[model samples]
Target: MKCTAVLAALAAIAITPVNGGPIAYGICQTGCNAVVVACYAAAGFQFGTVIAAAAAPATILACNAALGTCSATCATVALFAPIP
Candidate 1:
């Protein structure tokens, strides 16, 4: 009986749509590495790509502000800046 219930729960999770996406939690500047880690874990499988994509606009804006010499690496650094 217990095994059946556990299996049912697992099946429910397996079928659930992943909608949470990338979730940015807490303040990075204040050093919420733990929270950031937790949020990334909870953000689920595709978060790496989702997060990068979501952060793209801000990165572009910063790049433009800097006079059009934006490298993705540089933009990414600012995109996830602790104090930004």
Candidate 2:
């Protein structure tokens, strides 16, 4: 039993890649969401609303790119998973 507990503790330490905690996860998601909202607002589009690439301004495209990068980073660090 004691050996199993020691192994579990070691595993936990081995996996934490950053200052992993609830606060970090919340901050990561909040920041990512803010970027998306700001981008959408700038383009005169709100959340859940989509516009065609050809019709939308360059800001929309840049927003999408930023969102992708943000999501990937958050998942890898905070969630400990890939954006699959």
Give the top-scoring candidate (lDDT): 2
lDDT string for model 2 (1-84, tens) is 122233335446664444445554565677788879888897888855775768667888788888878766665565532111
Off by over 4 Å in 1: 1-31, 45-51, 55-84
TM-score of each: 0.21, 0.55
| Candidate 1 backbone overlaps, count | 1
Tens-place lDDT digits, model 1, residues 1-84: 122233235435654333221121122112333333344445442223434544555543343333222233223333333321
lDDT for model 1 comes to: 0.33
Lowest lDDT sum, 10 consecutive residues, model 1, at 21-30
Off by over 4 Å in 2: 1-19, 51-57, 79-84
